[model samples]
Target: MSSSAFRTVPASADVVIVGGGVMGVSTAFHLAEAGVRNIVVVERGELGCGSSGKPIGGVRAQFSDPLNIELGNRSLRAYRDFPHRPGADIRLDTVGYLFLLDSDRQVSDFAAGVELQNGLGVPSRVISPDEAGRLCPYVSTDGLVAAVYSPADGHARPGLVVQGYARAAAHAGVTIATHTAVCGIDTAGDRITGVHTDQGRIACSTVICAAGAWSARIGDMVGVDLPVRPVRRQLAFTAPLTPPAPRIPFTIDFSSTAYFHNSDDGLLFGLADPDQEEGFDTTWTPHWLELFRTAARHRAPALADMRTVGGWAGLYEVTPDHNALIGRSAELPGFLYATGFSGHGFLQAPAVGEVMRDLYLEREPFTDISPLGADRFRHGAEIRPEAHVV
Candidate 1:
């Protein structure tokens, strides 16, 4: 589809998806492929301007939870063939993911995680500290008891992935309305009848909440209190060195919650601060610069001399269990959730799109996603949070 294809929004659509991030666009793409072409995606900003734009694009099936592993595996398959399927090059370099462990407990825990992953058809393994060093030589191995390595886990270009989905969705007859804010969900009784947006009311029965950090507010428009909060995360890009950093897998120092990897021009790194407050705040904290430096020096001392060229802060749509809440909302009929992916939404977008498509069409999903339902929390079901989140 050409750029002029999105000149206007239709008065009615078969499906009205709120949010134009990767999740929303992916949902539209899969739905269109399912023969549900009368789909309209509404985004308050440009496509992928939300958390999807700032993602590090880590794709992996090394999760401890079975549902996460399944989602990752399905997404990994899609991403592997994305260049052909979506016709957009995401620069998917499968350099692998290396998680450095510094304690015996972590080693034992990850060993079990690897076993579980392997059982689920993921070839993740726990490796020795020496092997970890061999895999990512620049990262410090001091005090490291062991490591978990997933050769199939890797990174991709986030912007390209989002664009790929958006373009494919548009080509498949999905209408995308940018700068369109959904002010409210027009519902009759317990069923969604349409969505009232800044532009106008779009009459549609099915409403998908894929608004990332702003998902809770979207749910509120439908009288549903979604248990999703946004937390600020900062990532920095270093100046391109003469030889650049050695091409290494996305490596994480587990104990310190620090991670770094080689990009096309330089090194990209981030650290999780325990002091981070929950909200929609994306302001960069001055004190975090020192923390990041300390983490880099401790984990990858080779990055010590590299000057930070640029950095940006983004939001993580966090849930109580640090996992995503997918599936239909019981209270609000015809309302579906494709939000609260914590920090793993980019990698899990493909699988989520397929699953949401199946559910919206009232067909049995390819994989059972009942475990990711919001009802789990409502019914006091124990939420099994994914252990592998960076």
Candidate 2:
């Protein structure tokens, strides 16, 4: 069907991903590489042009949930070996993440997580304030008692990573049709039928709701309500200073509620605004800038002298539990979800795809993904992660 057509034509497939962000593209890439070629990825806008584009590129294994810990660990390996796969040369910067611990309880809790991560083969370790400064001297170690540092964790170019997945999926015979918005879903006898898109109706046996911020609306199309809500996050960067300090590691200042990493030529930074921040709105305000400045001055006094370049707002599809709702949706069979990631979607994409394919196609995954099931939420089983430095 052509874009000029008034009516959307129908195309058949095994799966239809509704969003073209890293979550959707990465899943398509993994599934296609695993031999599931009958897939169609429909995006409402250009590839990697959503929350994925605005992510501060903070990747770490500092998670409370064991599932997320395992997932992030696996994704790290994939990023390291991404170039081995044809066309997935997304440059993932493994610069490590240093999270400052402001309170004793916070320090003790993170120490426990560090112990758990290390036991699970993740090289996460707890360090003192001096050690934090040793890791990055730019940090203000005044009130910082301890910090969690994981050299194995890092950040990648979000847009390039999404493009890598989309391209890889395309090369593997998976159709990536961007700028093709999926308006609603078609359903039949207790199962998914097809997807109604701007281009045409794509008929698919399995419908994977990878539409990040729009997952709830997509779920409603099939008469099921997904408890996913979009929370707005604004990110920005400063002009480059003289000779970069070996690309500073992803830093999280717990006291300031701030986190930042690299931005190609400049230092990307962001913080939550106490006065104005939340809900589906992605608008940026001058007060938000003021809050970010307060954080920068407290964490890195040097940044106070730097000039603000620009920034943008993106949404985090947060679930009630702050964990992603993966696996099949029991309310709608043949309908799977890869949404409600809060903000961990990009880092968890590769592992998520692997697990999703293993569950949907192979019938059994290596690990138990039952915790991520939507039913778990209703059952009061939460997979709340430890790394809450959003």
Candidate 3:
């Protein structure tokens, strides 16, 4: 498919997908592979311009809950096979994931999480701090009590993954309309009638909101409450090391929400700011590096003084419970959503695409996602809080 194909929005489509990040393109690929035709993906900007464009894409199945573990596990397999199936080299590095724990409570919680993950076919295990240091030399065993390591989990290139899925989907005849902002969604009673974009009106029978940080507005267009809020997460890349950094696991100091991993000849440092306010702003604040440096000073002292060349900031489509929303709208059956993934959207995109495809076809998905429905919030229900978030 030529670049011009992605520029032209058609008059109508059988299904209209909002957002062209990893989720949207993945969904389009799955649906197209399943023989669904006349599909159109509408992106406000170029593909992967949203959260999906972030560097340091970590793929892991080390979660406290089974749902997240399953999603991550399934997606790991897909990412591992991406080069063969979707036919793209996403620079997948299976250096593994190491979560550093400080408190006894963190140890116990992670132990339980490891048990659950193991039951679900993930080879995650709790190890001593000494073992953690062996896996990643930079990790200090000072205050660390225990750590969790999963060899199957790692990181990949999000942009390449997006392009891979997008190209495959477009080649299968799915229309990908970039630079097309969705002005509004047209609905009649309990069904999606069409999607109105700045380019034109696309008469679609179904509308899928994979809009990530902007999903709440997309839900409002159809009278559905997605309850998604955007929070800025930032990370910095260190200058190229003189001797090149050692390949290490995607390591995280779980207690402080600070993390670091290998990136090219340097390293990437990130920390979730506890005081960060909710917004769509993605301006990379270099001062935020102080938070990670502070944590690293205590956890991994060597990383605190690393020279940072530049950084990237992106939004995490956060939900109250910090889990993903994946299901069809009860009120508007024609409307489906796969958003509010917090920071795990890129890692879980592949499985989510398959889930959304099965959902649209009214077929049973590989795993039951009933618990992830948007209606959970309306009914005063929330899934268990997922630990191991970085």
Candidate 4:
């Protein structure tokens, strides 16, 4: 659809989904496909202008937790079938994901994780350093003790995924209101009545918050706690190589949180800065590239000094436990949310969309997502941190 068509916001909708990123669009598509009507997705900027606008997104089911694994695995299947279903290529490259380990403890932990993933049909396994080197020739394998490999796990273009879902949703009668900033939420005796946007007020009985990094503000508007904070994550792309980059797995140095994979004729490098402050700032700083360089000097020496043409910076909507918050509001039944995905939102969008659709329909989802409710933090529940984060 053209930008002109998305400018007008409807006065009323059966469901108002805040944020037009992958999660929002996916939810819109699923709900529309499920026979729900008069759905409107409100976005402050263009669709996928938020975190979902990233260039390449990794899709994997190699998680230490079963819930996360199921979410990833199920979404991977949807992404594989995206071209036929929602109908878009999305550029999914199943080059697989490789996690390089340096310590015996790391190997032991990954072994347990591999066992769990395999039992859940992830096809992930622990391989020796030699096998890891064969999969990704760029790796030095100097300090690498072992590595976890999942051939089905890889990366896809997030922007394309967003467009695919948005197009599908729009074609299904979903009104996608771009450049429509949600200003306030109307409530009455614990029930959400409408959503006030910069364009206009939309009277909606149900509100789904897939607002990504800005979700906490939306939650506050409705007196619901989302506990999501935006943290900046940056990555750089290498200049076109003299000899085109080799086909390699999406490789990661687990200890340093450094990762790299083939992109175009070069490679893309990224690392999580341990000292990064929590905020919504997405300015792509060259300083963080040094962190990736430092790790590469030890893990993959060739990438330590590779030239970078440019890069992209985006936000990771993080929760205290680093797990997603997916549930309906206990106080306000009309409000529902699926955010705080940390860095896994794009990979898990499809499955979470289905969960949100089922939740809105008052039907049990294929997998029990009750444990991921916001109430867990309110009750001080001890949640395990996902170990396979990169």
TM-score of each: 0.96, 0.93, 0.98, 0.98
RMSD of each: 1.6, 2.6, 1.2, 1.1
Candidate 2 per-residue lDDT over residues 67-169, each given as its tens digit: 8889888888888888876456566778898888888998988888888898888998888899888787778887788998899888877877887777777
State the lDDT of candidate 3 residue by residue for 1-390, as single tens digits.
533423447888999999999999999999999999999999888899999998769998888888888899999999999989789999999999998999999889889988989999999999998999999988889988899999998999999999999999989999888888999988888878888988889998899999999999999988899999999999999999988888899998998999999999899999899899999889998999998899999999999999999999999999999999999999999999999998999999999999999999999999999999998988988999675266
Q: What order do you get sorting by lDDT, best first?
A: 4, 3, 1, 2
| Model 1: how far residue 124 lies from native, Å | 1.1
Global CA lDDT computed for model 3: 0.91
lDDT (0 to 1) per candidate: 0.85, 0.77, 0.91, 0.92
In angstroms, how far off is 28's CA in candidate 1? 0.3
Candidate 2 lDDT (Cα, whole model)? 0.77
Q: In angstroms, how far off is 48's CA in candidate 2?
A: 1.7
Candidate 2 residue pairs in backbone clash? 64-386
Clashing pairs in 1: none
lDDT of 3 at 81: 96
